[model samples]
Target chain A: MSDLSDERIREEAKKALREKGLKCVIGWSAEGTPTFASTEEEIDRLSFNRSCVNNLVPYLTYEIRSQRGKTRDGKDKVVVPVGVVVRGCDSKALLLLLNEKILARNEVFIIGVPCSGVVDPRAGGALFRKCVKCAMRNPVVFDVLASETVQEDEKDYSEVEAIERMSQEERWALWEEILGDCIRCHACKRSCPVCYCDECLLDPTDVAIKPDTTAEEKAHRPLWVERSVNVPENLVYHLARLPHLVGRCVDCGECERVCPRRLPLRLLTTKLEKDVKEIFDYEAAKEEGQKPLIAMSCMEDENGFIM
Target chain B: MSKSILRKDKVAEALSALGKQSVVYAPVKNKRGIVEYRELGKSASAAEIELDGKPDTPPKAIIFPQTEVLLTYRKDKDGKFEVTPARPDEREKVIFGVRPCDAIGIAVMDKVFCGGKFTDPYYKARREKVTIFSIACDGPMDSYCFCPSTGGSPAATEGSDVMMYDVGDSYYVEGVTEKGKKALEALKGQLGKPSPEQEGRKEAIVEKAKSGEGFTRKISAESIAKLDNSFDSKYWDDVARRCLSCGACTYYCPTCHCFDINDEKGGERVRTWDSCQFGIFTMHTSGHNPRAVRAQKLRNRYYHKFKYSKDNIGRYLCVGCGRCIALCPASLDITKAISEVK
Candidate 1:
């Protein structure tokens, strides 16, 4: 994909709506954040820059009911095709979504844009942790190429290796300090692109309870986790989310970016991503019919940690 | 009214002196480099008190914590259930270096938690035990501020015990309440009387602060008048399309006071900060939800800020601190949304 000028990208966004008949185009608004553009006038407000950091792929999920339009018929309701602007990382999220059968590849018209790297607002021009080690700066898949694909250097997993080298006690202490900062605000889970469960397993309502318990007692019962915000419970909540995102997380770093506490969540998720690469010899969102690493694992897996 | 002048060099001394008498919470940098309000004692730095702009986290947590245990329940040997209420910290504390908008945020929260017929005992206990020492903003901290638009000025003194104005080398402080007067007495000899020229300088500073800078966004009374009719408009669907429904905006907001009370392990009851943007915020025990759609949830945020808060409390819920604008991943600027109302 060739790098399209920010103006050219905006122009193409309008074209997608007018010519391609997309119900709406999702891109950066004049406010320098993700916006939905349905008309030419609204598309005129679309602009892109280094500050456009949000992965727009998450909005495609049904958790946000407004994004899914009304069905024409009772059962097989036809959804209007949605046009989305995707950076390098966002393109991969789309790929993973397509592989999971969550989204039909033809349902979305993608405008893939090549990138140098996005600026971290907190660090003021410094690349985000995920972008710093990004192996791909060009979209892996797209319908419309916004930029000519550019070559980029690959990143080594030194950060994950450093954490892997830590003693078990040292690692526990590190996680305790980090997760202690978590307020259980759920910002990280909510901002994730691949966390699309309609009712998350962590929700207390979804937990099974004894049949004899009353409604009030059912609400108060601790199934797997307590409502407390202690370090242990917070760790359970975060660590639980990592497995669900195992082969799906695009490492977009939206979770870390949106965290009010500024918890370095990428540290944990990236380790899982690296493990998937090492153990199963698989990288996420690379091809068309690719399955998740966990979905294709074998019984002869290494037991290095069992000792 | 007791008056005092606090020099820049003496800030540390004054804070340390105040700390000896009562706990003091000032903005200090955490290990992550984010400035948040922390207690002014062992391991905390008094020099890191951010006075130039709003701190990353507001001082509301001092009164209403992010998460608090309301009560601890246990069963006795006789198998009878017993509940013990959790007591709040009764020690007096001072909130130092709070910006005017955040100070107004405390005042707004007071209406919700303290003004109604039934007051939140937890919030009231903490609110009464704390003293607010607000630093009047000389101008908007950044381009996102719109305090004046919401009937609040940069130099507003709605919720402060002591209001301090920066005038050259020192701060011209005036005690606004009896509690402020008592606190000022501790710094009696350390302070000096301001000269007429210094008083004039303070007036000039307040005037400039009151006449806020040119803001990129504006929301007037007229624009919000017809905000109700726009509830069903397609504009909400468009905005909702891009909204990630993350709690960053509401959690970081200074005046958002919504909370959820739940039972933890050992039957301990706790209340934690919850956001309306979450899909399950309005989910009932019966599995019914009034605001099931994301559009309604998004609309409810704006309506609560502009319409519902005003009708119920006679004041807008938002203090225009701009945390929502600055932190939103989708750039869902409330100021832009408000201007587009009607």
Candidate 2:
């Protein structure tokens, strides 16, 4: 696909605020960070480039809703629709949000861009690891395309294949080395658009651990996951998050990019992504109104083991 | 006030000599070109030590490990529970190649862990066993450094036992304390007097480090003071809108000391690093969180660094290392945020 000029994208964002009445156009700044352009000046500051790497769909949740305007009357709050510029990866997240009923279809206006690839800021403009094997260069769902749709290369699972070739012990050792360095920052889960749980199960306070409380008194508190930075706890914390991501993960690569330790978190998610595609014969966010693989009937699934 | 010069070539000999008495840690780049502070191997020399800039992770882990077992309890044969302290392997240690900002960060942490009424015995034990060798930065390590603004210089030697200034092919070392003086005396044979040219170069480097060139940004005391009254400012909401609430900024920070203690199946009680950026950091047992909002939590971090720590310890918690600025996923630059504080 041909790239849309930055100026053109800026003008379109400004128009969305003024003409289409968007509360804000979630776009990019010149420094390649997320910018919420609510006014003309902010829209003027909006920029788009190969370095715009953030997936802005995570901002639409109630967690960020405090930034919205409030009314004096004690009435149900009416949310203003926001315009968001999306690359193929972000549009996939948006589709998952729409499919999960977490977000209303008409609530967000997606300004889709046909992305060739985004550059890793840390790697000096090299294509990000997640982008190298991308099968969706065009937005999965968009209200308008900023440019013509781009042709996507056939998906390559070579990286996933190499991991599969590893023996079970070797796979365990690889993950042990990777997760050993995790600081438990939760950057991976926080950056994930599909990980919208208000209280994550991995959080220590969320998992209840009552050890035979008396009839009137409770002593033991909840401890879901141990608060150590060692291998066993970190490994369990990462693997437990996979069940929640069954068919919803978009392989956006934001998790790995945000990691301070630069751990290979995407490799784990990519493994799951490949498994879902092969077993369920489903791809995440491919089309609107489709049920997620976890939500669909098992009878239709190609995995006979489930039957 | 003892001073001497050590040639770059003889650094390996000095390290080898020091290794006989103490475990030596130096910054070394991994296969991925990411620098980390690790213990020197038996065959490794000072050539492997990277003194050019700060490591990706600070040397705070040397004194306060990412995970530490406080104590372990075991059921004896008599059916009584016996508790034993899980003491770290005691060893005299040297951490070389720590930047001045990071060394200052250790001093700031000192104020928290050692200055209070209740000192952490675990941290105190480890800290008392380690000596610091702070290397001077000739100029700005990168585009994000701001040591001068935080009452630190690239040549500041606040917490280091010895300050080593990079002067071309040699290092001009000066002992700042009794410990440093003792270490210098021990390595007297490996050291030599600085030549006139080397002394001149050292002075020039110190001057350049003091110049504003090393600091591309500023976080003035006035701006920091303004933060005291700006808790409810809409600026926080704007700044934190894109924040993923990832703990990268706090985790990579040299002075962040928040921690959580938990018990494991092996009857081990462990304390590990925790971050205020996490949602459950302040979650109440009754499900009442005073700072449940993400913006509120982010705001508290700035206040703690610039306001609360100053109130408690008479020093800002942040040492202007710029790790938070460089690693924040949303590009939430603390220096930029400081400028925006009204």
Candidate 3:
């Protein structure tokens, strides 16, 4: 579908929120709305703007746990269910939550739309570069699919193919070149939906290697070796992020879009996803009840190299 | 000693009959030597078992799935929350043709999940309901198998309830548990008892496995105890630099059991697998990360298996199932790393 048609779907979602007896419809709207108007208004639906790029599931979780009720006069006042609008990839996030037993499936109303994909506003251009090549133009697991027709065309992974064409040394060189600009800001991690760790290992205090040491001293320390944005550090950092996405990353391209340097983060994830499918014959969040590809093992699993 | 001599042709009929009585999962070959579990249809042949070598994936998938719904919740209009248990169907399952190393891995997992303070009821329910029918490995399937060094034998009976050995013209089955006795009793009258020669053949197979190059790498378990003191050792940095940290090693490992809990509100909650190898695996809400670098993250993966799990579970988390050696893109081998640890 075109940009004009997507706006129409957004309007329909707004109309659904305007219906009677609905507590609040959660949909994307313009950014910069006043917090009071966004939360306290008695309007039919709540819309987020382009900054709403983060999956609504995490925010919904926060709301469900913290704002679900109020105590008045020693009695509890009930909070209404929040209606959420999700795209195909967003729906997969919701499904993963359900599968993990973190959230009940029936608590929130999902308005699923056939997503043509959304532009990452953090890319700071006409649109996020990755959005132009996105394949999931239509959502698969939505309660209310916005599009009538599904786009089943094969995604052109030429961008990844272009990188794959390079030799291993060349690929490593490219990664080093890109990661050299990393400030370790971790905006990419914070914006990710699947990155729901209670404690991140990057925090020096959490793992407690040494918090008082200088960067130069820490860099030479055995535990802190390869911790910088140098080639070795960048390679390790990039490699460390791949398994987190196994059977979970929906190829949303959110990380790349949010990166300050616009490093091709999605390519690394997508390449791993491709290998996972090829090696294990599995897809991440493709089927509702399908097992996480990485969790299961067999005794007969081929171990030809270790012997 | 008990022995049965069924013609190779009758093996299919025997397995088919067994399937009629219980849930039977066996390895079926697909492309690229990949192995997957398929229901044993009435006419399914034993030829589908692929006993010539190890399957690409382990049997842990059958018992401990990658992702399983633990419970479901519904919020009534009255705003009261109701939780519904999501349990797997109670069915007696027989995992036929499991390898010795894989079976031991399951046994290790059983100790970890079942004996812990927080019992995984889902895993327990499946464990209590399933019976393992282990097939002894006659020869090394690949170079990555270091079963000998890690206390694994090709034909070890450490985990299997019933151990099976393939003789030239017949199959010999021995009962190692009461469950195996009952299964054997059920199969009585259709087979001859074990002869002295069959028992001799079993010993020969076990001996062959013992002498193979499977134990090429000898790691002193005591050396792993020094890992705590070596926390800041340069060894981790060297390994971490080579590690892609892609989690293939942990994910494919038979004993790595870290997971993450998430709430997907349609009204239900879910929990999925998490890996310690990721930068965000231990990320805290306060915006601090404990394993910010690949070196630390990589160190956690080994230290947890060798030190913490041994302290808690009474054994190293690794069961000598050498998946990490075979599937690593960068050729990072755990056995080689462990050999170099000291």
Candidate 4:
């Protein structure tokens, strides 16, 4: 690991914040509660902790935009130009936002850091359950580097690799075994960083998943499918949840780690991620300024399937 | 009674004059064959413009950015919440050399933003202020493109404020709306009266766009409507198995506009974009995900595009842009699904 002290990093961050035209600096600070903070000075906050796991890019949506508030004189303050701390993966989100023109490059100052994986609280036991299989420990796009940079071993995809080793029938049976526990609570969706819709189709009142007794009875009753968690409905429920991450999932692994049942959620996502890389030769959040695979097109893209 | 022909060589001068008048965004090449919109400088070359092909990125970035700050709020000294409106950079922009499919995509977004009960004021202001200059595609630039399948011909003039056709050495320009007429008037000195051959060339290109191997994946609008009732159909499982749940289809789609909104505030409210294909999209606070599995999520994506969106908006959410078919990791093409929906 490259030896760079956290103290040195905070000193640099403080210096950047003091620069003229900067409104506020966004970085992770370990106040008794571990979360991202927008602070005016380094001394006012505690130093970074390994548990500062939240992606800071999401905060920019509100920090830089004009919302409700007024100065003491009753005049509105200008939209604050923010300075953000970005890791390699987080920088991709920033690049996407810039490419989308959501956040103007001039509006926010980026401090790119080469990350050496973050600790996930869900993965390495209850304390860090989400940190066990982090692929991007190194920050790809930091203005100032922090932490000792070390080359970690390649991630062990043994869980997904084992699933791949199964025959088609075994795989289907495995999914059926896992999905049989689903209760249709949307906890996974709520915790996802990318699941940002206004109205969800699975809402209780959604016409698509009709609440009418007749529709429900006809749909689940005939197949000997239990309205409760029987084999069929559970399988269907599990199938419904996986596709939502397609190109947008950055392998943050938040969904799997957050699952209360500890259903092998990461297995499903990792399998898809692996397939995407192998089949389409694409990786999610792999490059800065690269458009998400689905948002782009090429004249040479294979279209043998399209009639 | 105005027909103007601009020689291909004078295009830069015309663009420069237009840039002087307003912000002009044109295509420029990056590392790969990637074409992205960059501000047109005086030295910007017309040669960089790909009139026939689709850019690697969509034009939606100019309008509906990925992470727009809708509004910001702060606490006052008295602890009262103060709301401030995001001051948008309001400038007249002219988006030049957009393909027919992308132009239709913008029009589709117009329906979503302007035709809905809640008007997205941010999107509306940018869209209304900007002028679209569409370049007609003379032929299928990629095999995956199925603009004709989605009621869009490559040369269709459905969405452009102004439509341009390249005929040999000259570009035939026509005003599709009053805004286009005003934009054309800004370049009066560079425009020449059109010759009969230019008109003939334009027609020929239009004919070529129409006559190519039109998308063979045909599904009746009536059949798509029946999808809501056909939940037990084996097609869902068959297709879901092949689908890697990568969400390439919806993200690249011109009309697949399902999005999630959430608050990003460390302690306050901030909303950002979300997708439906994710298992988390419908997960409840109580730990119940109504759409918990891949099959249901995949079905929702198809139903949203083919059935639900059509029911709500009177048009299928998919515009046959073919971006999904081209980019899907598993090669699970929606066109094939539509064809197989018996």
Question: For residue B243, what is the lDDT in candidate 3?
Answer: 48
Clashing pairs in 1: A1-A147, A1-A148, A1-A149, A2-A147, A2-A148, A3-A147, A3-A148
Candidate 4 residue-wise lDDT, A158-178, digit = tens: 878988889999998777767
TM-scores, all candidates, are 0.93, 0.92, 0.53, 0.52
Best-first order by lDDT: 2, 1, 3, 4
The Cα error of candidate 4 at residue B164, in Å, is 0.9
Q: Candidate 1's residue-wise lDDT over A155-205, tens digit each?
A: 657877898999999999999999998876676776788887665666432
| Local accuracy of candidate 3 as per-residue lDDT tens digits, B1-342 | 345654455666667667767878887774323465555763244668765567656778678765566778888999998998786759888888788888888888888889878788888888887788788888666667777666677888876888888876777788778887667665664556767888788779978987854455455655665676888888776565534345556656777767655444454455545667665577654546778776799888878877887788887777676777765533456776766774
Evaluation by TM-score, superior candidate among 1 and 4 = 1
lDDT of 1 by residue, B1-342 (tens): 366688888888989888878899999888897788998776587877766667888888888888899999999999998999998888999999898889889999999999999899999999998888988887777878888888888889889989998888899999988898888888765678888887998898787866766555568888888796887788787667667677778888889999889887778899988889876688765656777766889999999999999999999899988988877766688887878764
TM-score, candidate 2, first chain: 0.87
The Cα RMSD in angstroms, rounded to one decimal, for candidate 2 relative to the true structure is 3.5
TM-score of model 3 (CA atoms): 0.53
What is the C-alpha DockQ of each candidate? 0.43, 0.46, 0.02, 0.02
| Cα lDDT for residue B38, candidate 4 | 62
Error of 3 at A112 (Å): 48
Please give the RMSD to the true structure for each candidate, in Å: 3.3, 3.5, 23.4, 25.3
Give lDDT: candidate 4, residue B16.
79
Better of 2 and 4 by DockQ: 2
TM-score of chain A of each: 0.87, 0.87, 0.71, 0.67
Give the count of colliding residue pairs in each prediction.
7, 0, 66, 76
